[model samples]
Structures are given as C-alpha cells and as structure tokens.
Target: MNERSLVFFVIVLLCAGFMALSSFEMVQDYIKPASGRSVILNHLMKLTVALVFFVVFLYTDHRMLFSRPVIVGGYVLSIALLVVVLILPGGETRTHRWMNLGYFSFQPSELVKIYTILFLAWYVEKNQLFMKRLFRGFLKPLLLVSPFLFLILVEPDFSTFALLFLTVMLTLYVAETRGVYVLTFFSIALIFFVYTYRMGMLNNILRSYQIERLVSYLKGNVSEQVMRAVEAIRSGGTVGKGMVLGEEKLFVPVVTSDFILAIVGEELGYIGLGVILFSFYGLVHSLVKVVSRMQPIPSVKTFISGFAILIMLQVMVNVGVVSGIFPVTGVTLPLVSYGGSSLLATMIGFGIVGNMILESERE
Candidate 1:
C-alpha cells in the first residue's frame, strides 16, 4: 500500500479505538440481558465483526462483485432479506427490522446499503455510454435502486433510507450520468413527497416513534436524551471531564450506539471532538485522493466516492442529532458507533477503497 493508504488506515484505527473506549461501559442488558457473560463480550463481538469484514474486503477483488450473476443474485438477496424481516415475529421490539438467526441478529438494511453502492458503481460503469438514453440506461438504474430504498423505508428505517438515497444520488452524479436523469429522479422524488404528505400515505407508512421524532425536530422541541447530551457537552467546557469520566453515561440514551459522539465531546472536550471530526473528514478525504489518483475504471472511482459520501453524511447526521440541530436519525458515527452491522458495513466499505488503492499501486 502507498503512504497515503497507510495514513487513512491508521486514522480509521484511531477512530475505532475511541469508539470502543466510549462504548465499553454499556449495560450488558442491551445485548443479551440474561446471557450471564461479561458485558465486555458485546463490545468485543462488534469489534470482531468489523475487523473480520475489513480484512476479508482487503483480500478480495472489488471488481468481482460486478459479475452479472453476483449483481443479479445480490440484488435479489437484499430484497428477500428485507421482506423476511417483516414476515418474522416482531414481539416486544415492535419493529420488523432484524432477522434472529439463533446466535446472531442480522440487520439486512445495513448490509443492503453496501450492496447498493456496489450495484450503482457497476451500473454506472456498464452504462456510461447509455446514460443519454433515458429508458435503457438512466431509468433502469433508478428502477433497480428503487427496490432497495423502498424496502428500507418500509422497515421504518427512514434515517438509513435517507442516507442511502443521498449516497446513490451522489454516486450517479459523480458517475457522469446525464444531468437530466438526476434531475428527473429529484423531480419525481419531490412529487412523491408532496403526494404522500397530501394523501397521508407518509404517516401511514412511517412508525409512530418516527413521526414523533420528526415532529420534535420540526417544532424545535428537544428530547430528554438530547438535552442530557447538550448538558454533557456544556459541562465539559473547553477541556473535558477526562476519558471514561463522562457523567452523561448515566443519562444519555444509547451512548454506545446513536449518541457516541456526545460522549466523545463530553470526555474529550471540544478539542477531542475536533480531532474526531477531523479524522473522519481526513479519512474520507484520503479515500477521495486515493480514488482520484488511481487509474481505475469509472465504476471503481464512483464506488469509492459514494462510500465516502455515505460515511460523511452519517457522521454529520449523528452529530447533528446529538447536538440538537437535527432529529434522531439512529445513524451511527461511522467507525465510532457500537453496532456490528454499522461497523461491519463501514469497515468493508473502506476496505474496498483500500483494495482499489492496492490495484492502482500495483499497476
């Protein structure tokens, strides 16, 4: 690997370390309340999943994913998984979002996001010439991506769906697809939005909790969890209360998952927050530079760029929600959150970028 690639990898590690540190103290009950195993195991499991996926991606050729069979099957698998979640029993959670496979609970929506990136990248590359043709190239790609987005939205995972939509759109834009195609998608999206609002279809589709969250955001009314997070940042002042000393651990909701950044801010203070955010941007920046410098196929470049955009948007939304500027998106801080699905998806996504860099350097 090149020096720049190494730097980006190191920055990823630094961010991951901080995430682990912040999440180490989460109540064991959150994962498996009755397991009787040490709570530390939960965090370790997340780390293990992340590292395994990253290493696997580093060894794999990203180009193989574009094979006709893989693309077709992968897209079908994502749709099937999304549908299966709804079929399974939701029970107390009341959200049909996960597939309980005895030992591991799988969140298909998260993995599908990664798949969507690869699909779009491949599509853009394959159809670069056909983009000007509205039906064959432009509309086809949009039609293919719609199933993934629709399933996710119906899962009531509006946050993840929103981020996914933005990333795909950005990827299409970068892929040099016709501007009119992108504009058409946006126009249809706006019309759909207005129609849903007018017909009450949006409310019918979204879960009650989601509606409440959006309402709170629109009204400028902060939730108790956000208020506690604000207090944590406020009390930290310039320096901080010190690592592992953030008192917000007692009150803030899901400190290890959704609101991990708030703990970083409280424990590491503004300077630490700056460092974390800077590392995030730096990592994404490194991806951009590596992808740009590499003499790769257009799809590869677009894939890496789209992945970076997704991570950046997730970080912004997570921080914004915690800081009271945006609604609770349930989007985790890229490498700085404590969910296996999110962490695994992030590591694999970045690993593919590394793979591209390796190929470029080899050439």
Candidate 2:
C-alpha cells in the first residue's frame, strides 16, 4: 500500500474503534448482567482476533492459497460450516445464520463469502483458455458456486447471498468469461427469482420476520427501526448532537450493527459521515489501483477486485437502509459493524490482498 492509502485505512480503523466503544456504552443499559458477557469485551476480543488474522495473512505467502488443493479445501470447509449452521438450533431469533459455540457465535455466511471469492478467482484463472465456452467457462462456474449460494439463501441471509452471487459474476467477467454467456445467466437467474417469488416458493424459505420486512418495504410501510434510523440522521442537522449525546439513538434498534451509520450521523454530523465516505473511497481507490497495476496474475487481480466490490456493496446497503432508501437487509457496514464474524473475515481478506500486492511488487 502507498503512504496515502495507508493513511486512509488507518483513519477508518480508528473511526470504527471509536464508534464501537461509543456503541458499547450506549447498549450497556440494555445488556443483562446475568448474561455473562459485555459488549465491550466481545468487541475487544473480536478486534484482537481480527488483528491476528491481519498479521498472519500479511506475513504468509499468498502463493500458498493459490494452490488448487488449498483453494478447494477452503471452499469445502466453508460449505461444511454453512451446512452445519443450518442443522444446529438457532438462537432466540430462530435465524439459522449463526453457529453458537460456548463462548462465541460464528456466522458461516461470512466465511462462505470470502471463500467463494477466492475459489471463483482460482477457478476462472485455471480455465481461462476455455473461458469463452458455454459449459467449461460459464455454466460450470455457476454450477460450482450454486451450492454455496443455496446454503446461504437457506440460511436466509439474502443480502450476503445476493452480494456474493454478484461478486462471483464480476470475477468471471474480469477473468475474460464471455459477456454474452454471463448476461444470459444473469437474465435467467433474475427471471427465476421473479418466478419463484410469484409462485410463493420463497415464502417457504424466508422466515416470517424476513417476509414481513420485505412486504413492509414494498408496501411503503417502513419499519420502526428504519424510521428511527432516518429520524436520527435527519435530527443531526449540519452539526451533530455531539458524541454520545444524541437522544435519537436510544430509539433505534440495532444501532451498533446494521444502523451504526445513524449513530455516526447523529453524533458527529455531516462532517463525520463525509470523512467516512471519503475514507472508504480512498481505500477502494487504492485497492483498484493495485489490482490494475499488478503483473498479469488473473486470479490475484480478480480476487482483489471482488474484495473491493464486497466492501463497497455492504457500505452502500448499510447506508441505504439507514437513510430508508433500501429495505433492512441486515447487512452491516464493512469494518464499521459490531460483529466479530464480519470484522475477522474482512481483515483476513485484507491480509490476503496485502500479501498479493507485495508479492506482485517484488516480482
């Protein structure tokens, strides 16, 4: 990374850490003492784990993961975890997105998302010569990625599933997959999605709350959470209510997770939000520059491009939901959200990207 890019990343990381601390303080009143866990403690533990992943990936050889066996193993392991989460009993919300261990909960969809990107990149590079062919290039890649998407969709993680699917398609396009074939596949998929929704097939898969949320969004009946989030942001005006001083945050549920931006808006105002937006743009711009200038390693370039897309997509979705432009997709802001699974996965991907960039520069 260049000096300027490093500065941008550090700014966002510091901002995220500060916001997380403030969020922890805000939620303390609601956390039960009998629960044996504190929000701050969980955030710190997860941040520690994320930092460890960052260091490990930074030092490790990126080529190790480029091996066929290693890529396949990682992909299979992600799939297995996704499947296991479905069979295990869900927590109080009855959402099958998490696997509750004794001390921590892991969201398998997060793992699946990163692994799928790596796997697709490797697969496309390995078959680049035949990538224009219908079966060998287009259909086959989609077929391989289908299981991962299906598992995540069944986990009822629609946002992750959709974003992952989009990322996979983008990777293929970057690796020289035929544009016609890719477009045809996307068209067919869209038709299938609409057909299923009309037939009520999706009703069986989506949870009651998920269905209700979508319906409310479609019918113009915005949910209370979204209303509160918008209200909080609008109430901030030009200057914020000041850090930890906003009364609106008290009414917004999931303020620390999906709607964390609302807190940023309310506490820090437009200046804080503008800083975050610029920082994200800088980070992604830096990554894209690295990908574009790197030596002709299709897999590495594709992976980094997909990673950038993933980050931007999540940020946009989170912002949209908070502003009531989009429905609540339960998508958290990249690096800004309060979940261990999300933070760890993003850091690990960053580590891989850093290693690849360094390796390319050395070559």
Candidate 3:
C-alpha cells in the first residue's frame, strides 16, 4: 500500500459519509419543507473547497512549507486564532470553541492541532541531538506547547485538549524524547487533574451539560443521544434498514457530525460500518508503512506519525461514544464528519503527507 492507496481509502470513506448525510437530508425532508439551501448542499460546497486545499498541499513541497520561518509563522497564527476565538463573540454552544467568521464559523482548535504537530516536527528535527535531554528534549517542548493546550483548555474543550496533548506527547516520544521525561510529565498532569477535581475547578472549567455527559458515562448511564445511537445501530443488524430508511437516526443528536456512524449502521448495516472501519484501518496502516520507510527523514516521519495518531484517536473516541463505551466528547469522525474546520484541516494534513511521500519517493 502506498499514498495513492491511502488516499483511495479516504475517498471511499468520504463517499460513504456523503451517502449517509444525503440519507439524513432525505429523512429531514419528510418532516419539514425544503429550504432554499440545505445542509447537504452547504457541506458539498465545503467539501469542494477542502479538496482544493488537499490538492494544493499535495503539489507543494512540504519542506518549503515546514521551513523554520513558515512553520513558526503558522504556529503563531494558530495561537492567534485560538486567542481570537476566546475573545470573540458568537461562539458555538455557548462555548469559546468556534470563531464566527462573517460567512462561516471556524474551529480554531482544529487548526492548532495541525500547526502544533508541524511546529513540533520542525523543533524536534532541529534539536534531534538534544531530544534525550530533560530541557531541550522534553521540558522546553512541553512548555512551548503548554500555551496551545492551556488556551484550548480555557475554551473548555477538554476532549480536544486532552487528545491534542496526548498526540503531542506521542510525537515527542516518536522523535526519541526520553521516555522517563514523558512519564514524569504524565505524572504531573495526573496530579494537576486531581487538584483540579478537588478544588471544583473542573466544574468551573466545563459547562454544565458537558459535566453531565461525563458523569452519566462514568456511572454507566448512557445519555438519550447515545441511547438512540446504540438503538439505531443495533436495529440495523446484519444489513441496514436501507439508505435513508432508518428512523432512529433522526433521534440521535448531532447525527451528521458526531454520531454519523450510527446512521451508517442504521442505513447500510454492518457491512457499511465494516467498510468504514476497514478504510480507516487501511489509512493508518498505509501511514505506518510510509513512516517506517521514511526512516532517513525523521521530521517527515514524526509529523505523519503524529497525524496518524490524531486520526486514530478521534476514530476511537467517536466510535466509543456512539457505542456507549465513552462519553460524548464532540469529536468529529475525520473525513466523515460535517464540520468544515475538521475537513479542511484533515485534508491539508493529508496533502502534506502526500507531498512528503512523493518527495521521499523521488529521493
């Protein structure tokens, strides 16, 4: 398997997602009159734009893009976007998670994830010899990334922050940072978590609904949304009820974004879900093979590996939430999710990876 094969799987997943969303849109039509512009149409437009980004990144040289000055600028821009989202008005879900642009809303946290990985790849490569040291290898990198994590946490996006932090640590580990240092940082993070819990800071940080979701999950009590999702999936059985025919998806909250898999299960059945999972597996497998072959190019290898980890982490959390195994974390299902920010960021990451693959092949 190669980059082409990896991208082919992505397209398959994308098409599957579109079919699910189209089915959802058809379901919605039964209850309401057709609006001038529908969500599916808007999503299509965003998908078109996202494809442009993917192509641009695929053709562009990643080395030029990840140069010290360019990566630094992008890192600074990402931080500024994160800060702006917090300070600006008209955020989503009463949280500072989205920056409302005049035309459309943007999720700064998503962009920050990409830039953080890119910046880290550059930083790690520059300090490869010092990666095993406490300061240069671990502490400095952690400190540098702390602001991004802290700002995201303040946005009260605990899920994204947690996952992003984990991804960063994984990147550092892959870059040969001291394992003990990473472990020590985890210990400190754990202690901080305990302190925050004891101080009731968690409540202050997370919204009431978010806390409720977490508590419900911890107590083995699934929320109505998850319940509906599970029911929808189970009803699909071996083969789905049929495309656009499943009624249960209508009851699942955020069906097009978070619980889209439930729709896949309900409409296309186990086969569709299996194909989606297999495509994702293929994507990660291809990425791992690419990383292994890029041993001579440590920076590219690390960045791609980190990106792969991010995708897998989101997939697990999203699937777990839908299946009642984890709390609702508002994580999108990569290419399948309906969010423009996630789609654009993911496409850009893939394009960069594709470029790296071509470059490596040329060598």
- Candidate that scores best on lDDT: 3
Each model's backbone clash number:
0, 0, 1
**lDDT, ranked from best to worst:** 3, 2, 1
Over 1-363, each residue of candidate 2 has an lDDT whose tens digit, in order, gives 663585478567556655745654664554523355666677878888988999899889988888988987887898889889989987676768887777888898897788888887788678878887888888898899899999898887888888888888877876788899888889998999778778888788788777778778878887889889888878887778886676677678988889887888787788878878787888888888888788888788878888888888887888888878888888887777788999889988888898887787788
Q: Candidates' lDDT values, in order?
A: 0.76, 0.81, 0.88
TM-score between candidate 1 and the true structure:
0.90
Residue 263 miss distance in model 3 (angstroms): 0.5
Total clashes in model 3, counting residue pairs 3 or more apart in sequence or in different chains: 1
Q: Write candidate 1's Cα lDDT for 172-278 as tens digits.
A: 77777677788878888879977876676767778878877877787889999899878877777778777656556557788777877667777768877777777
| Candidate 2 backbone collisions, by pair | none
Write one digit per residue (lDDT tens) for candidate 3, span 1-363: 877889799989889878888889999788665766687888998899899999999999999976878977887888888888888764446788887666677898998888888888888888889999999998899899999999998887999999999999888998899898888889898899878766878787788778777777767887888888989999999889998796888888899999999899998888989999999999999999889878477679889989999999989989988887888888999999898999999999999999998888788
TM-score of 3: 0.96
Estimate the Cα RMSD of every predicted model relative to the unseen true structure.
3.2, 2.3, 1.6
